[model samples]
Target: MTTQDWWRGAVIYQVYPRSYADTNGDGVGDLPGIIAKLDHIASLGVDAIWISPFFKSPMDDFGYDISDYRDVDPLFGSLADFDILLARAHELGLKVMIDQVLSHTSAQHDWFLQSRESRTNDKSDWYVWADANQDGTPPNNWLSIFGGGAWQWEPRRQQYYLHNFLASQPDLNFHNPDVQQAVLDNVEFWLAKGVDGLRLDAINFCFHDAQLRDNPAKPVEARQGRGFSEDNPYAFQYHYYNNTQPENLPFLERLRALMDRYPGTAALGEISSEDSLATMAEYTQEGRLHMGYSFELLTNDYSAGYIRSTVETLEARVSEGWPCWSVSNHDVVRVATRWAQGEPSDAQCKMLTAMVCSLRGSVCLYQGEELGLPEAEIPFEQLQDPYGIAFWPNFKGRDGCRTPMPWQSEGEHAGFSDASPWLPIPESHRARAVSQQDRAADSVLNSFRQFMNWRKTQPTLMGGSIQFLDAPEPVLLFVREQGDERLLCGFNLGDKPVSLNIEQLGSAHTVLSDHGLREAQREGNVLAFPPYGIFFARLA
Candidate 1:
């Protein structure tokens, strides 16, 4: 595949650094540790690896609050370590994509420190700084995704700075050309390092409404959205003025133009806004992001109708750009746990793995997803994520999914660390360790590998046009057509068997089925699918 098209329908495994592996016994994962595990990742049949943030930071939001973009945090090893990791990844036939958090920077960053010094300084306008209202209140009614007000008073500048996330993560002033150029320059630094792609973090948050207008409130009855939970006040407003501003398009174009200078490089954007799907369509159009993904599939909603509607909506809106689908990532609960309602069975994991991979777009498989690891139970005192700590008991934060990977079932700490891990590794996950699954042919890990490898052989699945068929509840039927190859994919998401007449599907024959996930049995013109079954068939 060409560099430009390698990501299309590619399976990109997401590795959360702090929880992946630790080489120095620091209880934190580092670059060298990732290099050591490159073989394991390559064996999973993934096209590329998207490593989460490991940049220099104060750990306020872990590595998301980047203090230095060009260097790796000592906690994650040095720049040289990254170079070795990238080289090894390439040698293993794996493209490396690093996370780039361009929307905000840690308050301790040198640029923010300089910008906050004085209003007359050269860097004064680097960040979004606004004057307080006459009543000494915040400039607007904006609220942070983390909690409380979005604006924090800066004593040095005697003004309030905007932060859509944590107060320590100040939003950048993308309206300023210089700021945009600086952000691009930082991006160029990574591109020059030989990374194949960039996973742009919160890409839509790159620009904000210049007017600083207060966002209109959403009716309590209509407050349901994708990213934030209903409990978060950030979801109370429509989030019009703070993010997904139209001004973000030109900046993205500018960034895309820079990527054009380097052939074979790609940009994948992560968008979260009021209408994330629309924003994804807009941000990824021609000459902008190469692929865009949102939190639509990551939410708690899991049904045939919701899944079909989300994919069909994106397929309708995103005509020119590509879509990257992910069922779980570092920020959300593991799909097996989130969608399962209770404990997930092997059938659920295998079915979800096949279904997500069968989608028309590229796919992101989180670190331990292959092993069917459920969300770890994290206690309040053990929680490290501030979002979880701030809203304890009610939300329990993201630490459950961010815990260390269980490499071995018998190790002191599942081979994740020599010292105590940053977050406790649950025994449930330990039981699903890689070593344990590697020995079981019918394990979820093996099923994911088998199906992913088999998927590569089916061109219809990779670049075909998807057409969803009308199916009854708990049954999702879709056809993927590419030139002479037409494939029909069907899934029984319900707990009971379902039968479908394949008479209209045209000469259908079984192509593949996830390991032991019951394939539909065809009798004459009818197909009977067992509970949690998945079937892929080729049409004449």
Candidate 2:
């Protein structure tokens, strides 16, 4: 890829600093810890590392509720520590992407403090504040994704402030041009810090309907998924008015224009709205975000038809924009457990990593995914994620996926920390620790390394258009073409063995079998696959 487009089709490893490593032994991972493990990240063959938020905060919603956008959180380390880590990552030929939560600020943030002091304050309109109804209730019926009503009553101003997440996370008023410029200025602070890109958090929630309209209720039967189950009231409405407003588009243009000032820097927005895929298409066009990703694939739907339909829908809508895919992240269950058809095998874990990586755009590989780690079951007593605690049995929350990274099999806390981790590391996860699979040739970790290295050589895989072929259940067939180079990719999505003849490739061109997924058997025109098998071949 060209220097300006280095992020195109790149495999960016996501590092959740809280779970990655701990150097101070304070039971939390920090920047110094990341510096200690740069070689391990480089060995995985990923192009960049998207570090989750580590800015100053009260840990209300972890680092997502940032109190200060300019400085590192003392719990994570000093700003100088982040600088050293950035230099080390660049030295190892890895780009660094930091998280930017542009839509909201911590209630304790100075901007919010000034805005909430009184209606007559200088920064009074900086946050989304509105007058309540005649009955003294919230202005509208917007629900917080975390739970309860989205509006929080601020007695200081005798008005309600909007919080799409925790009450501590107050939504910024993008309608205020000053707010947009301030958000962009904070973003530029990091871009000028020599970071390569940004993982924009809740970028779609930057604006709300200016009219403060009430969102229509979703049908009873359709009240599930999209990060919330039916048990959580957040799934009860269409959420049309609270976020994904059209005004956000021009603001994104401003963000993109600022990014353009720092050449080679890219922004990947996390979009979630009523029609997320369509919003993704709209947000990623020219003069806007470089890439957009949604929760379409992050759900429990593992059918080939669903995956094919999701990607194809976005493909149809996207023209000049790019898409980024992720099956697992810090917010949900790990792919190893979420998409398991039967007993989750190491093969399926490796296949899922490659499957997402093989898609038309860039990939975000969550930390510990290379080790094939499953979600840890955290008890209510040990739950740290408020979302899980609020919903209880219906939704176990994100702590299952946010547990500490298991670096060693034989250690107090899987070598993640000397003190007790914020979230407990599962005993099963310890068995799949990095030390256990670092050298095992057939291990999922090694297979991931092998595939990523080989993928770098396939220019077609890096920049090609994907067309999903009509294949039977348990099998997904797709052809990626870039100029004259065509690579046929197929995978067995189930536990049973499958054998089928694909007459599409009449000449049966060279089978690109050197990608280390060496088990897909091809006999003449028939392809046979074991459980969770993968196949990649170059067309004649």
Would you estimate the TM-scores of all the predictions?
A: 0.98, 0.98
lDDT of 2 by residue, 280-303 (tens): 999999999999988999999998
lDDT of each: 0.90, 0.90
Off by over 4 Å in 2: 514-518
lDDT for model 1 comes to 0.90
Q: List the residue pairs that clash in candidate 2.
A: none
The stretch of ten residues in a row with the least summed lDDT in candidate 1 is 509-518
Task: Please give the range of 10 consecutive residues that has the lowest summed lDDT in model 2.
Answer: 510-519
1-540 in candidate 1: lDDT tens per residue? 465788888899999999999999989988888998999999888899999999999999999999999999999999999999999999999999999999999999999999999999999999999999999999999999999999999999899999999999999998899999999999999999999999999998988889899999999987785656678888788889899888888889999999999888889999888888898889889999999989989988888999999999998898888999999998888888888845688888889888988888999899999899888899898999999999878888899899999999997899988999999999898779999999999888888888878888988888899999888879888999999888999998877899988676567778885455768888877888888888888888
Number of clashing pairs, model 1?
A: 0
